[model samples]
Target: MLGERILLGPGPSLVPPEVTAAMAAPMVGHMDPDLFPVLEETARLLRQVFQTANELTLAVSGTGTAGMEATLLHMVKPGERLVVCSAGFFADRLIEIGGRIGAEVVRVEAAWGRPIDPADLERALGRLGGGRTTVAAVHVETSTGVLHPIADLARVAHAHDAAILVDAVASLGGADLPTDAWDLDACYSGSQKCLSAPPGMAPVTVHTRTRGRFRPATFYLDLEGLWTYWGAPHGYHHTVPVSLVYAMREALRLVAAEGLPARVERHRRMTRALWAGLEAMGLELLVPEPHRSPTITTVRIPAGADDAKVRTRLLREYSIEIAGGLGPLRGQIWRIGLMGYSCQPKWVLALLGALEAVLTAEGVRLPKGDAARAAAARL
Candidate 1:
């Protein structure tokens, strides 16, 4: 039942065979000498994928949420000011974590389907009187499929001497993100997304300014300690997930082989095809052009179409997996992810054709067979 369906959902996207094979390659003790090279190469490849040269770039032993907590744990100390752009569900996670950390939270929000306005972010930072602050933003908000302007927001934050953190859980490998070039202080992305790996590990990259202190309030989620275990001295922070590390290492290697620029273009090309097909079927995208995430697309469910029913049909009949929107967008937007190995012509065409039949059956009328035709035309 596990491998009976295609992964076209928000993520953990389709894991390529190469990555899966690597994860099953072999197992060794965490402290074994042979594992050191695996750890080293994993760090190097993670840096390449993260697009940073920082020595501290390494994978956390948990999901993206663990990465988020580890990030905010050391940086956003009690009583400090932190600003998060809440455009969708994941951005609210920053607000929640910041509140938990006793940080003064200033939230700048936008309509769900729109990218966060850099002007609004700037204005919010200006309220801080140039005090050192941290700005948190989702690189691609999965709930709404809006790609926020990370570089511009980073520039604004830097001008005011503030740090910038990004949650790239949905857009890491599927889109273009140059961490060092964009002056992003710290960011974390999940292995499940564009990396085309399993969901346990979170690759985190930290620049010098936000390297954080040794042994923060928490022991398990300490960033620097994690780096130490993954880096020099090789001290054990926690029992590492060896298989997940191996898979992620191979995933990054695949990304490096494909080249980041070409990989991003591939995702974009596939996104264009999917969008064209969906639109041709008279389905509107929740996020408008130029701001839509290349990795995941949010399509409006047609009037009178039951969102859960359509998704169930897709999974039950076609064995294709996609997700519904989270938070306020639930039952309104069908999230179709074209990411990693899933961002291919065949998958796109299959999803479109099956979606056509399912929607037609659900009484949501559309031009018969037009979805596949439109998608092929784009390809």
Candidate 2:
């Protein structure tokens, strides 16, 4: 028996109704003229969402990781030095991918639950001594729910003459990321996270400078090849995922209709409400308030409380699903994602209500009704 449960994890967050409906629409041939317009519209909308006027904005037929691979494969060649900021899992993944591409990977490390400091990044770049250092960072670290200072990082990278790539898998639509304004060269995001769409398409944008410098080292994941195929002559690189493109187009349209600024504000409001409710329940947040991501919040479970038990009860009894921590934080943190449509006030209140009951029943001490009341007060 399938049960209806609220998706409150890092991703694949709740899909908007329109996106789902669009995906259900009839699929068309990848090279059909009618479908070409849809592809073009998708690229245009992605450029708008990414806040870039780049000529090569497009979607890849894979998940966010494919976008990451594509960016590294094209931008960083063998024997070049690539500097990566490691604050969490995604950053580590970037370093790994860079290593696989035969780039000399240098890491600027930060503690698991902390954001990478701009000074540290500068120091790392200084140690690398300039030439061939491609700086990479995770804009929003989903593993720890920490928001890195991308603008400052970009400034530091630019000073060293390094092109910066951002993995915005969790931040793209939910947070304010102005690619051009921030001077980010290349960035990739997933459809399932803040886009409120299914998880097949990876939306990516590359600056003109990056595009001009990039060389295709791999055929399938080559950004330059994909760009040329999608642009101008529109030569075929690969058969595009038709339904996923439809979903992305619809999702981007919803984002356009809502306006990026207003959508970001809504996410902020819902996140604040979740934070307030968790605070009222006496749960401690993993990251400091200044570094928290608006899309996801990681709360530290109280000492001696069973994390698995609490999460299981929330799922089985209340039909609500939150997440446990990753890596070193596995059993210590509860990740509550207020992403896209799931970032609604109703979901926040409902999650808090369910969590309160579960924790209270688990023999944790907290005043009854405080969490829901605190969340409501925020609303």
Candidate 3:
């Protein structure tokens, strides 16, 4: 049997027992009367977490990418302009998906480990001259652990008369992103990240202004169609995973009980401790402090340390799971996530101590016995 593992990767953060127990409740038919209220309550909780008053809020039945494709498919028409702020792996995904949908995709790129500058985005949109254009950005670039300024970018897009869509797959409940306050036309996130739920549902909110702009090319991901089923009449659109909805509802309740402000602070505090621990062990972080993500942290592999070996040892010996970098950053850095229920001081200190030991065993030089102490001091 596989051992119980600590999930400290980019996603699928440690699911709390309450969420799992909620999922274990007996399943109900998708169209059953009992399920409608549950769906309604879930959408209400999603709005609380998303900090949006948009009526078009619901959970898609697929993962985070499903939510991404839904917003793009609905908002961008063929030959329309889609401006994507490219910096890391997930941002490139926006560019790729836009192109595949036959949109004229443009990129406002920044260095991988750096946040996109709103001024750069402003200039790019200025040149586009805005006609049915959409600006897309990743709120938290999971691959690089950088948090872009979504509100500022949204303002820039609006200034150019363009609609803005945000991929908050890695931010959502873990970080502060006020959907309505930011004026994002659409925003979507994954259940597995900061929501402390399993990997199926993708919570999405579409501003009223974004509705009816264009008919989505696909039926399943159509935002308005999904909303119709989740709202007033509660008509059937598709067979959503009833159990997963249960899990999402419970997880969202947990988010509400802890309160978003406290939860965000906890994530920040834990990240600071982790940063202190890693730095004390003579490690370098990828993203600069100002732009770093509260939930995910990317650390540079020491010159002599093997990225694959270190991660493997972490999993096999310590029963902890963190991830390596993607795309051009492969073998260059480690991605450590402290999200949702996993964002605890104990886990932060535990990973620091375990990582220090593994690096030492790998013959990597470090200030012996300093990592955990530094992290504890901050905690």
* Span of 10 residues, lowest total lDDT, candidate 1: 209-218
Candidate 2 lDDT by residue in tens digits, 1-379: 8867688999988888888898888878877778877878999999999999988889988999999998887678888988899989888899888888889998999999898999998988887764677899999999999999999999999998999999999999999999999998899999988988889888888888876565667778777778766676677888888899899999999999999999999998889889988998888999999999999999999876899999999989988889999999999899989888788988998999888888878889876778888888877
* Residue 223 error, candidate 1, Å: 0.8
Clashing pairs in 1: none
Which residue segments of model 1 deviate by more than 4 Å? 1-3, 212-215
List the candidates ranked by lDDT, beginning with the highest: 3, 1, 2
What lDDT does model 1 reach?
Answer: 0.89
Output the lDDT of residue 331, model 3.
Answer: 93
CA lDDT of every candidate? 0.89, 0.88, 0.93
lDDT of model 3 at position 132: 85
In candidate 2, position 190 carries an lDDT of 92
| Tens-digit per-residue lDDT, 1-379, candidate 1 | 4656789999988888999899887788999878888889999988888888988888999999999998888677777889999988999988999998888999999999998899998898887764558889999999999999999999998888989999999989999999999989999989998988989998888888776444467888888888778996688778999999899999999999999999999999999999999998998999879898999999998998998999999999999999998998998899999999889999999999999999888887787778888889988
lDDT of 3 by residue, 48-163 (tens): 99999999999999999999999899789999999999999999989999999999999999999999999999888877764788999999999999999998999999988899
TM-score, ranked from best to worst: 3, 1, 2
Colliding residue pairs in candidate 2: none
